[model samples]
Target: MKTPACRIFLFPAMVCFSIIFLLSCTGQKIVSLKTLLMGMTDRTGITQTPSPWYKLIQASSYDRKSDKVGGKGWFANDDYTQFSGVDSSKGRKEYILLDSDGPGAIVRWWMTFAGEGSYDGIIRVYIDNTETPVLQENALKLLSGQLLAGEPLSASVSPETDLKMRGHNLYFPIPFLKHCRVTIECDSIRITANSRKPSIYYNICYRQYEKGTKVVSFSKDELLQNAELIKSTNETLKSSGTISDNLNLYSSSEPISAKDSINVNIRSKNSAISKITLKLSAFDTEYALRSTVLKITFDGFQTVWIPVGDFFGTGYKKTTSSTWNSRVDDQLKMESYWMMPFKKSCSVWLINYGDQIVKADLNIESSKYKWRSNSMYFGASWHEYHQIMTAGAESEGGTGKHRDINFADIKGKGVYAGDAVAVFNTVEAWWGEGDEKIFVDGEPFPSSIGTGTEDYYGYAWSRPEIFSHPFIAQPSGSGNFHAGLTINMRYRSLDAIPFMSSISSNIELWHWLPAIINYSLTSYWYVIPPYEINIK
Candidate 1:
């Protein structure tokens, strides 16, 4: 089926119904499964501060002993087989993965297991302190599109990766009003530190809304009620190609010499750039891809500055890949669908810093936009750490010097949309065993901590295989366990982190071998003006 002229076309009806449904109850801030589903496709919704404000948090199987910064066990690598708590009161052992109270929703869930019978467990989700579970099924089957949702909504990564090593993910939001508890019941499961037999790893990203917010708790009947909407949402997410037909097209093909630049200006008020397409050719394609930079200014604010290849998720090489927001075809035609709204005018520039003259074709599509007070400007920042050395953790029998590498530090009110990392390893050992730590609103500790780098990118076990989903993708993984380049990225919709004041994102450079590597990071976000980024 062809996609709707506009995905947000369905947003109004769903949101109106949700408001009425909430009014029928307590007339409070309404948060229901329908609203959350609608939010999944509403790209503009993320730019504004979320109404009925909430905090995005994560529940993971990280080593519990790693509690303090620069403290003992801080770099511990026993990240598997850990649980929040275990329950054995009801005749069977139920290992608790996540337990939270009050109004909230589980935006994303990711899990991967090792050893025999690890995936045979029964996963159950209890809502609102219910004695019974709203969902009870085999953990792997329920998470990997065999139950509840399908395809992009619930899937395992990299069909090329071994089935047992793939990461299983579920993006379907699960909301609760009073409480929520997720557990797995498996007789073969063991809760020992660093246990390899039937080892289980998980990361659950959820939202905790403010008090007095009304939320319709998730139930099996809710899934049945919204089956058709769910199917439509899945279809909308999987839709590819151009975004809309009503956009004004602007194109240019010019050769950019060394130290020269080309600019495309859209002199319009109340407009948004809906899509951007570009292609480059040169004798040294890889060098051109790295040295040719793309910059954009929205309403006079320079909000984007990055190498074209990394910005398009191709890294420094032309690799074929696709995601919800970006794509690179077999012919190396790169495209981005990020909505960039501007007030008066916008400027896009391609700057060539390499010695070779690069031939370029750039196309941008803009549409009429109704910019409101809450509308924001899209921004991207990029940086690279060349030949950085890693100190292998004690688990690998080396000096434990694992530390956080800042991806982006923004001082402003905005939402963190997503990020991508490209790495060049110099050894044949695993290089991404580290986890992600995200701090928002000047929090003393990170609000969102992940299990591992690959896990944070919607995969597991550092499997060197290519995969693509609507929100996450690994275009190249040759460097995961060997000496080469690897690219991994994750985009957010409902899982987008909004910060009122500031946000800092970091990832640990915990390689298994004490070797030198090159790492580059590109971060995507949207913010109101008066913002400052530490990328330069």
Candidate 2:
């Protein structure tokens, strides 16, 4: 007895209800910390169809390149130069870092000031040539390690205990439709005894896209509206381990003699190596852990060769503790969460090069993984320097030629993931003034350069306090400059360097004093297939 229009509406509404019911009967969408981490590494973000490229606008006041003979484009110069605010008829209150046409996003923002003023400056961001700022807040609170009370903001800070001290890092994505302008306002005060004005050091990294690309400008109102989703993500990141019931876990225990190699094989049609844990039981547990080599041949490629201890950033002796991607405890247990994907089969071998009878236990977990054509194989390599003497002029950015600590000499298509370094400082005034130089795609000079060793690892001013973050950590700090071994590691979760042909990554062996030091490094990367590589 219903009207014709009412009957038609009821039919469509019932159909919609049935669809919703069926979806409810099935499973709802699930998002987790792993999902967020995986999205950050999505290579699809690298566009090429219409040809869009990324650009970085680093406001290094004085040109560091002009100072060095063959220096990278944007080298260290902030220590020597001061950024004066934009002058107007009224006064100078803000310093413009970026004033560009966009369809882009500010990916990274790093700032550390030398002054009596606390880094409690204000930041103003304008989008689409708007007179009013889209985002404005206190710089310190905006990018603090501690959580804020208001709407959730996308940012992070390094460990407070790091010896290099406070190097403020902000990773909020500030996208713009047409144009973007950024400025910082700080009080002028005496910073150093020699300097009269407050000086600010900064590096702003951004990505520019081709015209007509769509971008959603940042909005505080939108963030406040969706605070629940942000809360969920924060809670998920704080939780540990897999929350799914479908996870597959496997374990194996075997006794290995000196020079004995034990191989653990996994055969699957379409699967991946998710997680691995290694534990050693021997009379000389420390020696066995330090000398045992982990070799992984996935789909017939010798992509991994590293000492187990060094792989976890525990060094030759266990003197510290950490819990993250690679974790080690006082009980001599090590764990790795690096995902290794394979199609036909994958094998992991533990080669004991030391003279010790050890009982090794290996636990592995696997899950279904969708392998794409452009997806690369996980790779790792290790290198060591018995005793490296820091000498001559050039190493300290002087006239003499500089020497480099080669982390990796890779060829073919790949992305430089991250690295771990362990140093035995003999006489330490400070063992790491060295800057990182990464030459991409066989360029004559390095395309990517950094300020200092600790800055590259996400801290500042030569801080050596122990800290552990999701992506970077300092497990050992030596407590003092000349104490002993200090180990630090960083894993690139949001910023992995990609190369088309080749990449040569090195750290200038620059230190305060000409002291001999023992150095060891493990570099991790991802490479395209052929299952073979040149050993350079």
Candidate 3:
């Protein structure tokens, strides 16, 4: 029940008068990990998807196996992943749907032959500078297809048809392609329908944001009293006393809500303008967005700014804004970025919460100083539109591609020691199939539970897997990547309260599994802004 955002405006809001801007540069910290990849200072952006990714493929090439019994998360499934009877020149195993460097418009697919009987193929499309136009020129209005059986099946690019299966399963409404970058090549195959001997399922999901077209969920009387106001500044702390006092939860401060328009691009290639200490700790902590803890203190001054760090993206959904005037464009998904060593002082943590701004206002970068622009009073643009135009794609609401929420850098471990926590992963899990029971800060470390090896930074099961003559007490930062990587695996959600449950955790399988239950394990930990102790 949240949808209402479509004003368009066209383009006519550029008001800025400036008000004493000047933070050129001057302070940084957190240097290690071989001096942050040897260099730092980078910026990249790209998110293009207006139509060209329509999916619907389920095969059953005559009796092998087909079982999806029952499961619901992304809401209904008809099973996918059918490159169809393969061998069409053996091509199809490429990803990066669209990457100006990283943000949205992604593409990462693998294979999975469907079942039933008669497999086919032909779904390959790619375009970045290949001259645009990858699909939809009028292949019967581009394409529109749909099929729906019963029980536990569903597919829809929506083209409607005729068929029913009591409550067993079968639904497909596919055959409508509208956003770009497509691929589905299986032109000749037949599965006239059977029973127990056909299998087909495809799931590499993308293109979502249509729950009323996106206004950015918010309706408890529109929140805002300061929207739930939890601002707890200095409630008190004393670090060299070693520190302690009125600590309802050490130090805290809350005043975030940007509305829109925030682009912090800088990968380490040496863009100059060092000295940056930005800290935004959400107070009273319990699980303030996965576990609240962001510390990015960058002042290093060697000209090394390394953080193209995969352009930051991979599951982030908390985009909502129904009636404040209407808004939707908070697409920020990142899984890597925590290395500050120019002159030194680096910390990271933006743990899911699209359309953000929680006590920000750092903007202290300088090779000489300039950007903070918008004139100061706030507002600026010349508009030629060549490139660099982020925030878009998720379908309707924007900024939410399925990532319940997580923000950690527990370099201190457990209940947070030095206390720079912002841990808010109400729940998460990754490794599946036989023998795997993980329990960190609480006791039990059964050795990461298997499956932790994939090469190019993908599947992870790092840590956990403890046995053989003792050694216990891990968690100081799990096993340090650059000296960070807390331990988590909850799968929580007992009747709402995963922060309202965008997808708090509901996936259990002793058999059927996709990408090992969507996403089994992917770890990330970093802190530099200032977890405490003179982050200057």
Regions of model 3 farther than 4 Å from truth: 1-78, 81-110, 114-120, 124-536
**What's the candidate order when arranged by decreasing TM-score?**
1, 2, 3
The best candidate by TM-score is 1
The lDDT per prediction is: 0.87, 0.62, 0.20
lDDT of 3 by residue, 257-322 (tens): 543222343443322222332333233221222222232333432112111111111111222111
Return the top candidate by lDDT: 1
Segments in model 2 whose C-alpha atoms lie over 4 Å from true places = 1-93, 98-101, 145-164, 177-179, 189-199, 208-213, 242-245, 319-324, 392-402, 443-445, 531-536
> How many pairs of residues collide in each model?
0, 8, 146
TM-score of each: 0.94, 0.79, 0.24
Per-residue lDDT, model 1, residue 532, is 89
Candidate 1: segments with Cα more than 4 A from true spot? 1-29, 192-197, 394-397
Pick the winner on lDDT between candidates 1 and 3: 1
The sequence of per-residue lDDT tens digits that candidate 2 reaches over residues 37-67 is: 2344332322111123333333333334434
Where is the poorest 10-residue window by lDDT in model 2?
A: 2-11
Residue 133 of model 1, lDDT score = 77
Give candidates' CA RMSD values in order.
5.5, 9.7, 24.1
